[model samples]
Target: MLSKRVVSCFDVRDGKLVKSVKFVNTKEIGEVVGRARQYYEDGLDELVMYDITASSDHRDIMLETVEAVASEIFIPFSVGGGIRSVEDATDLRWAGAEKINVNTAAVDRPELISEISHAVGAQSTILSIDVLRVPGGPLPSGFEIVTHGGRTHTGIDAIEWAREGERRGAGEIVVNSIDADGTCDGYDVELTRTVVDAVGIPVIASGGAGKPEHLYDVLTEGGADAALVASMVHYGEYTVSELKQYLHERGVKVRMHY
Candidate 1:
């Protein structure tokens, strides 16, 4: 297995880094560029910048913020939110992002995933899946795939969509649990495992990461290649370096700077 990576995420809104629980009640945390630079210098394997409110607000990602953050970071960077077409992904790549993450757009049109992947290579395309358990009783015949920043449900099975994404050429998939997001109760292991088993490509588990031990659990127990973290780091609860050290001590192979 590849060494587990510490991936840092910066949820941006109106050009500033923000943090929230379950994608609501956002609070501005820091400057996007500053946070990106700090994480890069701290030896994070990759950086993800998400415009959390763009889709819900119907606005494009802030190009200036993307340019600013991209200029400061050297590692692979992904920018997502409100990207609905091949043109949008191209523009983000031109602005210096290494990859483009699509959530609402991909769910709306699965064909776009293949088109974008063909246009920019699969390595530059990432499909971000936002999932939640069907309330009450047994899960329905299909897994629930939510969209529009988790405000709307697509009624599509996430597992089927992930498999379709791989068939269409998505290089990577990010499984984000809406219920577990910002809650930090540890990742929804069952949910992540389901997606990972269904897809052939790499899967980055997002949401519900509150502690270093959680990272260890996701990598070893949950079968995630990498984990996306937001709240803990955004609120200064822990640093990426510290998290890597903790993971390393727990027998998980994580990239460390110190």
Candidate 2:
């Protein structure tokens, strides 16, 4: 059986780790490298870092920060934001990222997905989709894709976009709910299930992971391959070991050690 992964997300702004509620009211968490090493030591399955402002500001990813974090973690480390070309992805890979995530740039040029996958192989390419619930719209899934740190709402249907991403050589997709982000309520299981059913690739459900039960719900009922966690792990609410032990006792398959 495939293990359900618990991924820790670092939303970095100005090279410092930060957190936000619905992508607003951002506040610094601390120096990123130390926090990353701490999480790695805590037995996290994987780690993802995002230059939250890179795309909106139209700048390249912070390679220094990426390298810094990558040096400390032994597991898969994925980085995204402001990756506009194949060269950028290559640079990140060289800097130690095991996976390259493409968001706004992929939306702008869908072929960039193919290009990166072709260059690095699909297994190393991840499509990160930020989705918002748009009720009463022409969208079939009632979810719309948002970009540039949830600052721009692209009217594209979430399900169709996920399908397109898979067809274009994206090996994995991270479905993050803009509405559920930082709310600590739960994941948008409906949104996650919609994409999971629409594509053949593995889907990582992101946003709104409050407690262990929420993770269980998304991984089992929602049919997600993994659950991305932030606030719950970030604010001393739970450690990676504690969360894994909770899920393991409840029959959710997860790696139990660092």
Candidate 3:
């Protein structure tokens, strides 16, 4: 099995790190650059910085903020929000982002995924799918792909979209659960497993990571390559080193903290 990776997420809005429930009622936490620098120094494997409201507001990601955070962190970083075309992806790479994550834009034009992947190697593109479950069993409350920062539903089956994304050349897929986001209960394991089974690419599970044990559960039981965490890490509730230590002790393969 591949070693589980610890990825820290910074949900930026108006150039600040903000935490909110289900993408609403956001409260500012701190500056994005400072927190990103701290995590990079603390041995995080990678960083995911997102302008949470950019797609909803129909604006480009704050390149100035991206450049500032990029200069401070040495690890691989992925930036997303309002990334609509091959040019957008190329500009983000030029601005120092290692990968470009596309959500709303991809949903609006599925072909863009393939176009960006072809323009800038598939490895440089990430398909970020925000999902919500509708209560219905026989269907397993199956995934619904959401866009525009969870404000709009694309009416596409999440699993099918993930499969198509892989076929379209997306190097990776980020499955973010809208219902479980910021709840701190745990990841929606079933939701992750379903997507993982549907696609052959790396699936990074996001949202609802509350504790070290939760991380463990998702990596092992949930079968995810990596997990993206925000609230737990941003609020000082858990440290990257501590979580890695616990995972290592549990016999889960992870980069050991020095």
Candidate 4:
């Protein structure tokens, strides 16, 4: 098996790193650059910074904040939110973002995925889907896509969206369960596995990662290429190195050399 990744996520609002429960009740945690540097120093494999209010508020992503955090972390850094065009994605790349994540805009116009892949390499385009479980919904997977930081329901079947994203040339997919986000109970392994099986590309499981066991479950049972962590690390519940060590000792392949 390939080495599994432990990614630290920064949900930034007004240039401050904040976290929320189920995409609500957001609380500011700390500065983005400082926390990012700390995580990188703690052996984080990658970092994802989302301007959480950018798309919802209809504003551009905070480039200055992105640049600040990007300058401090040597690991791969991904920036998302308010990306609507190739120029926006290219601008983020110029601002030192290693990858560009898109959600609201991509759902509104699926062709943007191809447009971005053509302008930038497919490897740099990440399709981030925020999903909510609806048991009796009009979808086979019983899951639907939510956009604008989990404010609007798109009625797009989560499983089908994953397949379509792969077809449109997204190199990776981030399946963030809105219901599981910030709860820290555990990752929605079932939701993640559904998407992973539907897509041939790499899948990253996000939301509800509370401890090393949660990460392990998602990486193994969920068949995810990586796990995105927030609350567990943000609140000092665990460090990136600690989580990696836990996984490594359990026979899960993870990067030991930071």
TM-score of model 1 relative to the true fold?
0.92
- Flag regions of model 2 displaced more than 4 Å: 53-61
lDDT of 2 by residue, 135-154 (tens): 99999889999985578988
Tens-digit lDDT string for candidate 4 (1-258): 579999888888988999867667888999888888988888999998888774444334477787777788888988887789999899889888989998889999999999998888889999999999999867898999988557888889989998898899999999999888877899999999989888899999998988799999999999999999988888897889999999999988999987
CA lDDT of each candidate?
0.83, 0.89, 0.85, 0.88
lDDT of 1 at 255: 74
Inter-residue clash pairs, candidate 1: none
Q: Which of the two candidates, 1 or 2, achieves a greater lDDT against the reference?
A: 2
- What would you estimate as the lDDT of candidate 2? 0.89
How do the residues 135-180 of candidate 3 rate in per-residue lDDT, one tens digit apiece?
A: 6633334678877557887778888889899999999989999888
TM-score of 3: 0.92
Q: Which should have the higher lDDT, number 1 or number 4?
A: 4
Models ranked on lDDT? 2, 4, 3, 1
Pick the winner on lDDT between candidates 2 and 3.
2
* Quality of model 3 by C-alpha lDDT: 0.85
What TM-score, computed on C-alpha atoms, does each candidate reach? 0.92, 0.94, 0.92, 0.94
What is the C-alpha lDDT profile of model 1 across 20-133, one tens digit per residue?
A: 766777888888888888888887899988876645442444677888887887889898887888898898888888898988878878899998999899998999999877
Candidate 4 global TM-score: 0.94
Error of 4 at 145 (Å): 1.2
Give candidate 4's root-mean-square deviation (CA, Å): 2.0
